[model samples]
Target chain A: MKNNQGMSIIVKTVTRVSVWLMVLYAWYIILHGHLTPGGGFGGGVIFAIAMLNVLLAYGSEFTEKWLKIRLLHDIEAASILLFLIVGILGISVLGGFLTNFILKGKLYELISAGTIPIFNILIGIKVAMSLFLAVLILAKTNIENGGEV
Target chain B: MMPTEIWLIFIISICIVGSIVALELKDILSSIIAVGVVGLGIAVSFLILQAPDLAVVQFVFEIFAVIILVRAFLKKDYHKEEPSTINKVLVGVTLITLGAIFYLSLSVFKLLPPFGQPLFETAQYYVQNGATDTGAANLVSAIILDYRAYDTLGEVTVLFAAILGTLTILRIKKSKNSQEVTNEK
Candidate 1:
């Protein structure tokens, strides 16, 4: 008997492309968050969706290269550190904790929104990288343990 | 119809359906899947509630939970067992109780103001104050980092603790034979 549950190339390709589009769109949203409703977490998730799509479509071989699990994990760790350091800088410079008005730049620009944009970028990187690592680890470990539960 | 009301109803309905599905599934795998569906549905509902931050956090947590659960289940064996009449009645009662509690809670809390409104307003006020306050346009940053820095610090610490816990539990040890091979090489 033929199993109909197997993935098809067309479906996989469509999803993969859509996911990349979503990741790009998410970056656009996050970068312009000062003027719009989109923020770090939203963009991060969108990027993660694309990563997940790639994994689902091409399996482990694709993920090993594209996802770069170890590098992403390091990025996640570093981003968390960056977030902390940024917060500390804000507190030390502004004489209070996490205050970002210390270095307000031009409004509606990429560098505007004081510390918000930087924080957003850091959070976005951390979230996206962490999620990518989690997914990769889970997928690989699942294979070692057995098939999907 | 008001957007808020419509969203509220949507969230409530999703919750009800999700809970019922999660409770009623026979197999453990099926139940977990149902819960995963519930989680995603709730994450969408969080978006509708205008709590995008909460929604994102929920989305991430759900992904983590589902991955961990699936991995755990894969490592362990599972079986489908027949449900007895008592079990059915208990489940039904439990569902009804939970449903009633949720309905009452939502209905009772009419006109609950948005949580972040004050924070947003504070950021605006600070902006008007000029250089005295940080000039970040993102009000959330001002509040999160400046006004509530200690809280953020504590939260980060808690996150670190949690990560450490997860790593400890999840990390696998290399075999001595592998270690010897590596040493020889």
Candidate 2:
């Protein structure tokens, strides 16, 4: 059944083992963004790459079955809106746009930074969804225009 | 331990060689892989320069770039065509001009501060106070997400616009004429 579409069995096996690890690592980077080097944008790109690995290994039909393009589009827009709302909330509460309003916890702690981690997460979601959606649209369009996978 | 300048020079030299190989390669796939190697070299140089944040991003970005390029290549029929005489001349001229510009830029670098010494007053302030103010151990993250968040917001907006533009341009037209043609087929 898995042999009918997409790449060979070896590629599928490797992707299956690696994709989830990639996603988990991406989330780790986003969540630990404040304490680490990689932040939202970097983690988000990793997340999108993980999804792209799935798309490439299993074929578009398999990917579309689980990940709806419409849902991804909506989520991407919502993440941007949420990021803006976070900024506006900072303005309304702290009298400045994107102000660090929340309590600053202990240094080097997981929940130390007030709004940086939150912003990181929001930006992560936004970047991941937007990049994935753009690639998916382009791939779909290419297929429609009679290009091979 | 070897000096960072030595490491940087080594990595940058490797990157230059890799880029030259990428450009000169006839096979598209091999060229793409060579380009990926150049990106990896740049990431290493970033690490040597003490920019771990940029290094991580560059590493991951290199993977995505190579993957995307390979996918795009897979979609098109492979063609091995020699550069025409006009194109060869144009490329030679462009390279000469770029080399001249780069050589001229070397003189301008001397006017700037030496490596690892930032001239900006804001840099000192950010490095000194960023951790205490933002409570983030990483100063780079603190500066990007807290101190200068407006700049990041602008960058995100640009990304959003680019994505929107791609979607708009690539959206499949579902006009009546197209629908009729598909139906007829």
Candidate 3:
């Protein structure tokens, strides 16, 4: 069975709205992570689920085209690499690894911390992309393995 | 009488019951649905504990596990009755032991006890200084990637191992493919 089918117009609309809302909420959580409870991992996964919803509603091909697997792969790799580089640079410049305040800015602004926001975005992208890959692999396996899924 | 506490209790009860249903359900599909309920419960519990980072990880892994399990179970036969008595007994004993442990732990350990002061104090110290020092508002993020960077790296590696193992085992190999065809005798 297709992931998205036999849905009333209302259900489809609700799903679409919720998916976007989740994406927005994920960002909210990540941006306010320092001041609030949620952080990079939390927000990242929520965003990933939101993406998954889109894939389920449309199709894998459309979702992949929208996200572009190549771009997703690059984002996934870049994010992990960025995380590591930030730590290494921190150790070199501030005598500790992953130190964000080495070149601190205003606390509340977008670019306040030298690397917190950057790390947040990187973590978010890495998590979402890896999860997307996992879902893709699972779907492909289900089809290739010849199951009712 | 606080509203949040009431809501929390209800959520916990739902989780416990949902897990029981997952363990007991005869239909595998329903069992999977119950597992999703259990995951939702854990995520809510994480939110209440002020660990949104953990909650997201829980949610993502929960969905991944359930989907994989469902897919794998789809091609397999489950019409035969399972020897469920042993499973039930094991689950019962485990739950009782956990409950006992939780009761004893919470009753004996005070949150702000002298011995616990240092632990919490350090956490607070990080919460305060972490933002300025790490320039990250999320103190948990600072603690995870800055204070415990090595640990986080180790965890990521562990996750990678688990995914690798799953993919390797689930893949249909040539030898197994031939055996499935000829071994029906």
Which stretches of model 1 miss by more than 4 angstroms? Answer: A1-16, A106-110, A143-149, B1-10, B27-142, B153-164, B174-185
RMSD of each: 6.6, 3.5, 5.8
Instruction: Work out the iRMS of candidate 2.
Output: 4.0
Candidate 3 or 1, higher DockQ: 3
Q: Write the per-residue lDDT of candidate 3 for residues B93-117, one digit (tens) a residue.
A: 9999999999989956665554213
Instruction: Output the better candidate (2/3) by DockQ.
Output: 2
Top candidate on TM-score is 2
- True contacts recovered per prediction: 0.22, 0.67, 0.29
Residues B1-185, candidate 1: write the lDDT tens digits. Answer: 67766877887787788788777777777777778888888888878777666676677668757765764464434645466557678878998999999998996666666543443464456566543354445555445545565675576556556655555444454234334554776
- Candidate 2 residues lying further than 4 Å off, grouped into runs, are A1-4, A143-149, B85-96, B174-185
* Candidate number achieving the greatest DockQ relative to the actual structure: 2
What is the TM-score of each candidate's chain B when compared with the real chain B? Answer: 0.62, 0.82, 0.72
lDDT of 2 by residue, A1-149 (tens): 23227898899999999999999999999999999899998999999999998888888778888898788888888887887899999988999999999999999999989999999998999989988877665555443343221
Question: How many residue pairs clash in each candidate at the backbone level?
Answer: 6, 0, 3
| lDDT per residue as tens, model 1, A27-128 | 986676554555666677667767766776667666677656677767878887887788778667866556664466665556665766777677677666
User: Per-prediction TM-score, please?
Assistant: 0.67, 0.88, 0.70
Q: Residue A108's C-alpha lDDT in candidate 2?
A: 90
Sum up the clashes in candidate 3.
Answer: 3
